[model samples]
Target: MTSVPHVPVVVVGGGQAGLSTSYWLKSRGIEHLVFERRTAAHVWETTRWDTFCLVTPNWQCRLPGHPYDGPDPDGFMKKDEIVAYVKGFVAKVAPPIREGVSVERAFRRGDGVFEVKTSEGDVTCDEIVVATGGYSDPIIPRMAERLPEMIVQMHSEQYRRPEALPEGAVLVVGSGQSGAQIAEDLHLAGRKVHLAVGPAPRCARFYRGRDVVTWLADMGYYEMTVDSHPLREGVRDNTNHYVTGRDGGRDIDLRRFAREGMELYGVLDDFRDGELRFRPNLAESLDFADRTYNGINAAIDKHIAQAGVEAPPPSVYEPVWRPDAERTALPLDGSGISAIVWCIGFTPNFRWLDAPVFNGAGRPAHRRGITECRGVSFIGLPWLNTWGSGRFGAVGDDAEHVVSTIAARLEGAAPAIQAAE
Candidate 1:
């Protein structure tokens, strides 16, 4: 008779979150294995554009024991730098990882142990930490199919460089972080750019005398959890503030692009009859973004006053440009747009993990990584614990919490193990 392999814990990813969990589990003397179907840098190397950089400063690269050690802690890490950082964490952790081993399915078995089916072989484990970060599948709109066959269309993930695009104006849909940054990339490259703006907010690169992130960190913003948030779980669906770390880290002011030669429109409504349709919400969306920007600044201003901090004289942004007329439509033939980049974002897919832990919207239903099932948990999800949960900033905290929870459960079940023996 053949004996089946078993591990006390199984981590589904080998990224920073997964590696962080491994670090904590190792410290607790827990036996486990991490399954990663690809290298840690695969996503960074493949999906990100050439000029992509972390909008947050390098200081936020807090991967458990391996924090950012670069010379410029305040500066952002570019594509290569970010990849290097993740790889450095993997090297330092030296996690017991099975690379190239795909986790086909994971479910809590009838016996309480988890059966994690993988490309390698099935294994039973007491606990499974799903660290596969939220952004899984690119969300290109269904309207993309109606576009002219001659017009090149690609999701933001596939975009690399402006030179790689067809020669003509490029229409970038969705003005979240990716859209804004990509539009800036093309604009800087002297490409005729058309942007379809969304309600994604924006923040100044530097507010007062320091980075806005630093101010927020000082004000305990990073520590703010889901429970404490005003919007609570709804904040999870909020689009990221559009900013850029391309040059020396700057706010991606879409209005500024409008002031230049770039054309701006409202949210993309549809694509039909050889024309692209837009909702006449350009002015509203821009106002929404500015309000968020000013609102954040206002909070910082209040904090400065109460804390008795001397900083630069506070200032607010006035709209640099407004649409002369809301453009409702643009004919594709003369629009000069030959390529379309969809920067809407992605939805996390947990379909492979056939577990009842998911909510109605297909999101993992858990409080800060702990699921109702004793051994099934999630990590590396936005708002998993705090605003920084999905990023390197607070993944360690989530990882520690998950490992501790599992450890406590094991201790509680120890009597059963002895009884069975």
Candidate 2:
């Protein structure tokens, strides 16, 4: 039998979250190893489309000890630029990351240490950090399986460009940021596009003279904790915004797309016998999105007035709508819709972990980054403690917190081990 090498910590996944944790662990003088199934920052390098850009601004790319201090902080980073940025950070920090090493299994041993079985070998660690990020597996609805085989179906992750898709009208399911952006991409490429609008909050790229994100940061919105937030449950489970980073950031809502000659449909309900069905609440969903946008602007305006701060003139966006056919159901045969792209977001994957640290939904069950399982921690989960916990700008803070907890636990265990010896 091969003797398992022991380390103080083992961090799985080498994306932003794992790298951040590695940095903190090194700073605290903790002996650790980081295992990445692919190259470091693999998702940003391969998963994103060619024209994809960071939805958040460049300034929010805050990793531990490496903040974005470039000339265009407000500008969004493209896919290549983002990959380069992560690479630069990794070079600077030089985390002990074993790339292309897949972690097959990770479970606690009888001796209380974690045995992480990997392609290389098994590693025993006192603690384990799962920083695989929130977006794990692409979530496609069951209705997708019912779609006709003739329709070229794909998840947003597999979509590379508009020209690459089958030549016909494209039906994009789920009107979150990816759905809205992909619909717009196809429309610009001269393809007839139909967007299934979901209820997602919309916000103008710029409010007053500052970026919407900047205003939110100024208002301490990002600092709001789950316990103290007014709409804690909603904020925790809210979908992505109907906005895009292309062309210097802009709002991409159902109304805007409708005015731009894209057919808007309500939530996708079912598909049967080559006919797709949708709910008959397209207008109501658009109205709800608008109200949410307006309420956010109203709150920003109120803050400016109460703070007595001089700001730029308010920018008003008039909602535009074009009357179209009531498309509750459409036959896929001759509708010119050749492709269906599902952008319904992602779900976390923890199948490799044989620990009882997951909730009913298979998400890591933890308050902040500390789980019920001792010495097991999770970072890069949405609403782990605050609104920004999973975001690039705020993941470093969560990583630091988890590292501190791990350090304390290790310190306590050292004395006990000495006593046992």
Candidate 3:
């Protein structure tokens, strides 16, 4: 009925990954259009919690060549600082991002280009980079909705602090980093905190005196190849720990949360009236839930041994590190917990992307975020490059690869496009 507008390239999302991809594309003189649903600052600002900070040290904050190796290299950046950093990055490297444009759909035209439908307008492009992020959609479980409305609930994204929650014993569901942190925060704020330990693998921010992430980086854990190693499977299985804000330096780790008086439970059995109920067999189930965690710790120990680093006594963290507790579940009726924090995590939203590039997992099928679907690509996904693809420090490598891939696809037309546009 109407004519669809056209652009040479369309980049969806304005987050770190999308902005990084756009920066690379611009470097090669490729003209592109980026569709951001909100203002540039709001994207990161909206995701921030009251006590949010980056887990990676400043030195590793480099976006490719732009290293965050300032004088305070070892320190972590706060959420606001991160937002400023991203803002500065975009201002200097990639200016004039199309803001407030929401992408509604994108389908392969089956020609050599794509048709991207957005809240602003439809634009056809030869290539599309879906950098919307893996955390675009929160994965709230089906059981959650059925819970009594009187219990009060909210997801991690919507939570600012404990002061905002109801004045009752808080039931922090999902034992990943966020749940643990929130539970700890609520407990410290003087509310009874009960953390639901799901199938999440637990890990301390630091094992000995060294940061686990730093140690992993040094061991080239991020450099593992998804092609040959089965580590992708390993990573996928144990990726829950990093989901929450609990790396020691950034915030109090989970063990400290538990030590500080948060009641830890195995799983939620049901909820009734104002009293939230949980499974009774906590200790045994906790052991079962911690197998993957212990496995990872063991793997790290093996790595340390191989590197000839002095291994700490195994007794310090026997079996699983958290101390034994006589009672597990804590009731949450009086602690104004009218809201629930669903720090549960996110799933890739590719529904708008009608391209046939997705794998069975509904994720875009790609060898390192470069998809086979003509003109369709992905970036900013977990472990896309090394172990840091989703992190700022590692995005540069994938960005470079994606830029190169797009360059080859464009052949020699890059210069002409830049000159014309």
Candidate 4:
């Protein structure tokens, strides 16, 4: 049997979360190894489409020791710019990162140490940090299988550009940021676009000559926790804003798409014989989105009033609805919709970790990234501590907290191990 190399700590991802954790560990002079399945910032380099740009402004790119200080702080970064930024960070920090090495499985040993089996070899570590982020696996509806084989389907992660898809109308099933952006991309590419709307929140890109994110930060909205927000449950569980970074940051809502000749439908309910059924609540969903959008601006206005900050007049966006156009059922062949883009969302998969670290709902059981099981921690989970916990600008905060906890635990006596009789 080959001997397994042991280390004090092992991080099992190479994205922003993992990199941030590694930066903190290195700062403390802690010995650790980062096993990345691919190269650093693999998601940004590969998963995102060619025209993709970050929804968050550049000023919010707050990796530790690498805050954005460029001339265009308010400008949104494109995909290549983000990849280069992370690459620059890696070059500067030079952490102990092993690219192209994937951790296959991780489990606790009888001696209270973790055995992390990787493609290259096995590693025994005193502590393990999982930084795979919130978006791990692309979530597609089960009914997707029922669609006719003639219809080509792809997830938003796999979608690159309109030319990459078949020559036909596209049905984008989800009104989140990705779906809205992709739909707009397709429309610009001269493809007929049909968008199925959902209960995604929307906000204007800029209000009163300031980016929406700037306003959000000024109002301390990003600092709000899941437990403190009025829509606590939804903030923790729902998809992000249905806005876009395209056109230099602008609102991309169902109304805009509908007015632009893009077909809008309700939630994709089910699939029948050569046809797809949609919910009849298109009007209701649009109303809800508009209310949520206005509510955000209203909060910002109230904050400005209380703080007595000088700001321009707030912009009002009226709702746009055309109930007669929304169809409940459309045959796949008749609509010329040869492709379906499933932008439903992503779900994290931790099956590789053979530990009881998950809750009843199969989510990682952690409070601010600290698990009940000693020496195990999680980072990059949405709403882990606050609204920005999972974002690039705020992931370092969570990483710092987790690293400090790990450092404190490592200073004490060895972890307790239950011996079998």
What's the best-to-worst order under TM-score? 1, 4, 2, 3
What 10-residue stretch in candidate 3 is worst by lDDT?
Answer: 412-421
Encode model 1's per-residue lDDT on 19-75: one tens digit a residue: 999999999999999998887668888899999999999999888999999899999
Per-residue error for 98 in candidate 4, Å, reads 1.8
Off by over 4 Å in 4: 231-234, 413-421
TM-score of each: 0.96, 0.94, 0.85, 0.95
Candidate topping lDDT: 1
Please give the RMSD of candidate 3 to the true structure.
5.1
Per-residue lDDT of model 4, residues 1-421, tens digit only: 7688999999988888888999999989899999898888789888989899989899999988888877888888888898889888888678899999988999999999999999998889999999887788999999998898888999999999999999989999998889888998998888999999888877778877688789889888778766677886456787687777775788776776688789988999999987789998888888888888888888888888899888898766786656675689988878998899999999887878888888888888767787778988898888887877887888898899888888888898533322100
* Candidate 3 TM-score versus the reference: 0.85
* Candidate 2 backbone collisions, by pair: none
Q: How far does residue 381 in candidate 4 sit from its true spot (Å)?
A: 1.1
For residue 99, model 4's alpha carbon misses the true position, in angstroms, by 1.8
Between prediction 3 and prediction 4, the one with superior lDDT is 4
Candidate 1 error regions (>4 Å): 413-421
lDDT of each: 0.89, 0.84, 0.68, 0.85
RMSD of each: 3.8, 3.9, 5.1, 3.8
Q: Considering every candidate listed, which one attains the maximal TM-score?
A: 1
Candidate number with the higher lDDT (1 or 2) = 1
What's model 1's lDDT at 190? 99
